[model samples]
Target: MFSPFERMVAGRYLRARKAEGFVSVIAGFSFAGIMLGVATLIIVMSVMNGFRQELVTRILGLNGHINVYSLSAPLEDYSIMKLQIGDVPGVTSVSGIIESQALMTINGYSTGVMVRGMTRDDLMKKPVLSDHFIEGEPADFVGYSAAIGRLMSEKLNLKIGSTFTLVSPKAKVTPFGGMPSSRTFTVAMIFDVGMYEYDSNFIFVPLDAAQAFYQMGKAVSSLEIVTKNPQHLNTVKRDISLITDGVAGVYDWRDNNSSFLNALQVERNVMFLILTMIILVAAFNVISSMIMLVKDKGRDIAIMRTMGATRRSMMKIFILTGASIGVVGTFVGTALGIAFALNIESIRQFLQGLTGTELFSEEIYFLSKLPAVIDWNEVIAVIAMAFTLSILATLYPAWRAARLDPVEALRYE
Candidate 1:
């Protein structure tokens, strides 16, 4: 605890007069550096957190948490498999899916895309796909009818009730050797899953339509499944393996998109490390300011020592002066950072409007809007680091001031 005299002197030192203008300026820069460092760290970390969360929800929602496949062949009896998988503990829903690569032609434009098939009920269960219906209802996706993503719809200039021709790899032998099977389909609906990759390259049709078109009969390529807790996928996979008698292979969302997710995590960590350097630099400012303040107050240190002030009191006074700047800077920075993060979406929109340029373009980041998610624990950790660094920066300077010899310091005065 600081004595009244120590607190008074510390406060007066921080509010340095015109004669100590240089010291005051150094202190001000130190304060500003700490504030900017902390704020930048908070904003960057929040954006990364938001991005990862969006990637998980928006991407995994349509894709399901896990995939179950028959190791030997296509899943012919998916009804029984779905029922069995659904009964497994932690299993939420099981949807049969048929997936194949095909080329779609519309308005003289030919583009390759991934075609997927699922029942109306199954499609409805995936809110990421179902809730984003921009054009038509799921019921409209009947036999020979398909749903396309918004990007695809735009690129192909398709609309509800517009027709397109899908060419399959399956060929029919004829006098012309082999000809790819082709079918005409009417566009029934359009959806936007937010991810450009999916929106630009995926199409969905009724399960029966896909089976009939692909000559797959009742067989499905795989079973898409959702679980109660996606984070516990390995445990759930093990349980599902028991139910399937290990005949079917199981892969979680991580397995399906490991590279992308891993890259995100690695980038997040690297960014954190890189941004932490800013705070360290700010901490160096604190050290410099404290050292300069100690030098400027050498006469005061000598006077106080002659007045019977203990070395401990001298150290405490300087420590309090320097650490106060850090504390105040950290607090102000935290408030600013959280406030900015909370309003980041609005700020992004405002900036885009002002600049009249697209920000957070779907074509670039696969997200149309900027995202910000504040993690309180990370915020707390940043604050702790800043506060601790501030306290540490004062130690050496404070010690030097406390060890000053009154006779020697006053001799130069």
Candidate 2:
């Protein structure tokens, strides 16, 4: 039985090490370049993907997938609207939410806050808020109780059972002046969502308490709807709008955070492209090495041609060599990438402590730590790309080797 052309060429290239010292070094560098590039690309992309996933899960967990707000004033019949919206396809849950600007004061320390009022039953449905009590109970809001964010609590120096006055500005007709303002309630509990913006600005109070404070008679600013599948948020929003006869404006998660998501996607793509260049440059090194190999083995090639070795066979040999570099490098890189992605949190903490500075500060990046999410599709793509570039890089040198005339090569030798 005859050996296949690919196998013969691969075996020969693999064994041709003694006289090919420089070629080996070039191949090694090519492998190293691809390994580093692919690993870096995977790790970076996974981290970005992780951050994006965390944002959606955390933010959407607290804030519903869609919000139905009145275009004119407050929603008239929140109960009826909730029922109607809940009946919409894909709508899993609906809750009425009231938002008002208020000043919270304790011990002469005053801070402006956005009070989010919700019923105890509705509060339980919000996973983000429900899991992050850290201090007090949501059900305790029946008697002037409030759940403040962690940052807000820190800034105001508040704790559980701490009494703080909530001064909400309300327009009232006065005899001596054009307008008069009235204050609202008192703070009760503090909550932390691990997100700076929410923790620093938002406070949760009882729905009835907020209604009385704002002089709203059983009306809410918006009805937050949670869907079974977030990908169908627009569909859910549209259904809600149709059910309400277009009287209310329905907003989906995409509308609320499109810019941030877009930025994350752009950054991921840019990073991949940049890192892929490293592998490309390394593939070019393979080209240089193959060209050198052709020069060094001119005599051997001429003798082989004289002995009836085909041009196609010579080309296969060089191509196989280049491809082997890519294959080995890709395998190593993929392993390293998966490992790093799985342990990114610990790696991030180590670096943070080593640098003596917080790498992912909640105050700065909206997250307190790094995140990494490995996608197998991305891994497959990188491997395919690396192998393709490696094979492509061999074309010119392989062609030159194949085109060499036996007589000319022999004469030079």
Candidate 3:
């Protein structure tokens, strides 16, 4: 409960005179420091959060949440495993899948690719793959035809109806020691999953064709199971474990990409702590400026004490004065941070165009675009932390001003 007199005095002190310009400048720096610190913290945190969310969505969209692989051999009884896993309460769909590494050669160029064997119906269930058709049709996906990513198609000069040779290193034994297995398949579909890794390294083919190519008759490499939510996969894993008789590798997307996700989280936390020091430094500015103000207005305080103003009044006035800077800065910073986060992609593109440089590259960061997602709780916590530090910074100066001996102060004046 700040009184009218206290507020009036605090306001007057904040409107610095010609002689108090230096103190006011310090206060300005304090305000700026806090504002920039809060803004930077919010922007960085939001970007990290968005990056993690986008990665999970794309990764899980292409791959299953839970992957069950047969430990000793190829999954010969995948149909039974699929049915049993499909019955799990949280499980959405279970499909037989075969994934293997092979070299694809075309137009005198060769690159390593992961061959994924999925039925057309099951492929359509993946929104990232099904919806991102850069230059292919759904009808083209059936038969001996295969689907290739946009990057793969671009790099190897492939298109719908164009064929490429897949060379498998797993050679068959023959009279001439061993011979490599190789086959040519037509490209019927092309997709851009927006992830550089997937776009450049993945090829999809129908299940039966993949079985024939891989020489695994009625056998699959693994079972891919999708869940209603990837975050709540523990119960789903337990249910699936009941079906798998106990070996579930890559039980969820987090497990599959643990190192990458954990790095993002660790980097986020470290950045928060590092950036918070900016606000902490700003609080010191508040303390230094407030102490200088008290020294400069010592005579005025002596007069006020002599005029019967209570010590509590002096303390309250100074608290209001210093806190005004911190409070205003925090609110302004929050607004600036949210606005920046919302338009981060547009801003990044504009900056890139203006500067003629690649600011965010898909090859390094994985996503084709920069993303930002603001969490309001973090914003509130930042504001509170800054406000508390600022108020605390004003305490020593305000206390010294309140405890000034009127007679002793006048003798010096």
- Give each model a TM-score: 0.96, 0.91, 0.97
In terms of lDDT, the poorest run of 10 residues in model 3 is 243-252
| Lowest lDDT 10-residue stretch of candidate 1 | 239-248
Ten-residue stretch with the least lDDT total in model 2: 178-187
Rank ordering of all candidates by lDDT, starting from the highest? 1, 3, 2
Clashes of 1: 0
Error of 3 at 18 (Å): 1.7
- Prediction-by-prediction clash tally: 0, 0, 0
Question: If both were scored by lDDT, which would come out higher, candidate 2 or candidate 3?
Answer: 3
What does the lDDT read for residue 62 in candidate 1? 82
**lDDT, candidate 3, at 388:** 92
Residue 121 lDDT (model 2): 85
> For candidate 2, what is the lDDT?
0.80
Clash pairs detected, candidate 3? none
User: Per-residue alpha-carbon lDDT of model 2 for 132-170, expressed as tens digits?
Assistant: 788766557786677878887787777777777777677
Model 2 regions lying over 4 Å from their true place: 1-20, 176-188
Name the better of 1 and 2 by TM-score. 1
Model 2 alpha-carbon miss at residue 195, Å:
2.0
